[model samples]
Target: MKIPPHRYPSPLGRCQPEIMDVETTKRDGWQEQHILVVSGDDSRLDFVEREFIRRLGNRLYGGKRHE
Candidate 1:
């Protein structure tokens, strides 16, 4: 769910809305260690992280060495 700058939703409920600013380069993007934020009604960030590990395995997260 990608939101464009010019097309942000107006307002809703008790939650205060503010735009999150981030600087990114094409080479080093989401694959690198960085602060990411999920801005929606659900906790998709947790879901994404879990899915990434599930697909890629523990090495991505540096779990341990199997002997």
Candidate 2:
């Protein structure tokens, strides 16, 4: 199924297109999921985000980057 970019619906903005991602990961026989949204501005889960940071040793990212 394909939705034309022009037909992409965003509940937060003035009809502009936005990108979203649903990620699933498995660890220790359990499945976990997270949704990553990329919009100019929008919503979130503060508590869950904080918990995720805590679980990751308080690091927002654990990868090397080129700057």
Candidate 3:
């Protein structure tokens, strides 16, 4: 017998549909790396930026800035 999946209510609540519309632009060529386009409230954008910097650090800029 197969078991049914259980769903838990999220403490954060549901996401805003209007605020969740995201668009992305694609680029060609090896030098033109793929980009993530985030469109939303400032807080959301800020959060993504902070996370990228935290995880990528100087590598975000190809690591040449630190050198």
Off by over 4 Å in 1: 1-45, 58-67
lDDT of 1 by residue, 1-67 (tens): 9786696665664487565545444224555755343332335457776666455554445555689
Please report, in order, the local distance difference test score of every candidate based on alpha carbons.
0.52, 0.47, 0.51
Clash total of candidate 3: 0
TM of each candidate vs. truth = 0.19, 0.19, 0.19
Q: Show where candidate 3 strays beyond 4 Å.
A: 1-34, 38-42, 45-49, 62-67
TM-score between candidate 3 and the true structure: 0.19
As a TM-score, model 1 comes out at 0.19
Q: What is the lDDT of residue 15 in candidate 2?
A: 75
Give residue 45's lDDT in candidate 3 (0 to 100).
Answer: 56
User: For residue 34, what is the lDDT in candidate 2?
Assistant: 42
The clash number for model 2 is 0
Backbone clashes per model, in order? 0, 0, 0
Residue 47 error for model 1, in Å?
0.2
Instruction: Give the Cα error of residue 66 in candidate 1, in Å.
Output: 19
**lDDT for model 1:** 0.52
lDDT of 3 at 39: 28
Candidate 3, residue 28: the lDDT equals 36
